[model samples]
Target: MGAEGWRWQDSWIFVSLVIAGGAGRHRRSAATRRPEGIRLTDVLATADHLNRSIPERDDVLGAVRRLAGAGLVTVTDGWFRVTTAGEQLWRSRPSSGMGTTVDTVQKLLNRRCQPGDTDWTLDEDEYGIAVQEYIVRLLPRPRRSPETAQERAEPS
Candidate 1:
């Protein structure tokens, strides 16, 4: 998987959409054989909460478009559902390395975004900051500790 091609936020938003789809209740719609997929609003709301980024509709839509192109999700009207490939993607756990951002995000997602889950009691502001920090840590740049920054500033 060329996950490297995708921005961290885009990948996170895609997972958020998948979780939202799984959590949606199966409502029958006469026009479509499949059950009512998750609403775009709901998915966007979840992504905003998880990433604390409050991404523009276009941003989320772009991610959705990419996922659709990859056959990871199917969209109709304003609803979305995960395809078989999406399920596989979700099940493929990130490599487990202690203290790694990927592992932490994976654990958090599993704990809080399970299918059919409805219990979320986290403070919105705090959770948002937490999500933001987690995403920042996943960036490819070398992490610079505060002490290291201070030492660099203090020339010999």
Candidate 2:
């Protein structure tokens, strides 16, 4: 994959798929870990081998959005599955030299948008805004309201 079209997170997801043997979803519990499936976190962990840092939640969401936008995959019930086109793109990738790039992303899409196994997919823009909101939620809490602060300062 080239190093321009995709955000880094997208490459991580694709490479994770390649590494995980086409497992679409990550197993949540170690006890549930299967030979076929891998954890999402482990995807990031796998990226580490490529010298790519694991993405934060927002980046992961963005990657998923990009994939969905291209109809390469679908996100449903909190899982992602590659479509037939996604599979082709995955297969087309060189055995070595993976990078994040628009070209790479396009290669993943391969100008094909196929129906996926998932029941749902998100609109890229809406999903992006939603993920931004989620990131805001993750930020540290703001200072207490003036009234609450005053009351607390006054007495128990």
Candidate 3:
């Protein structure tokens, strides 16, 4: 393979590593952020807690792992201090990672709803209206069905 091939392979590898890494980074960031009084294990804790309260960056775990790999944390000790750049990034970036439950649930629904259809751009109010309309018209909903008005009008 050429240089391009190597680069493409490396890109894929990076993405794979990121996927494998999970929410580690965000956890580290959170650990670093807590006050001096807070305990690492107490505040920035187990998988269940991570999954429950702090719905941070999609690649958060990877970030934490990277921090560990870079000597930011002693994994065995379960303690980490935020690096300067990480602090900068954490401060500057939007908190889309720690998303709302509603946003997350709606995202799942959006994926299941369509691929080729219109993209999900509706506001919450609009979605509520759309869903209501959809439910009301769920079975045998109106469409520009073939056949004259007489056929539909007559019924079965």
Predicted model with the maximum TM-score: 1
Q: Report the lDDT tens digits of candidate 2 across residue range 59-79.
A: 555666666666665545544
Whole-model lDDT per candidate: 0.55, 0.51, 0.32
Q: How do the residues 56-83 of candidate 1 rate in per-residue lDDT, one tens digit apiece?
A: 5445555555557666667665467777
Best by lDDT: 1
Better of 2 and 3 by TM-score: 2
Model 3 TM-score (2 dp):
0.26
After superposition on all C-alphas, the RMSD of every candidate to the true structure, in Å, is 16.7, 10.5, 20.8
lDDT of 3: 0.32
Off by over 4 Å in 2: 1-5, 21-38, 95-156
Report the poorest 10 consecutive residues by lDDT, candidate 1: 113-122
How should the candidates be ordered by TM-score, best one leading? 1, 2, 3
In model 1, the Cα lDDT at residue 74 comes to: 73
**TM-scores, all models, native as reference:** 0.50, 0.46, 0.26
lDDT of 1 at 140: 98
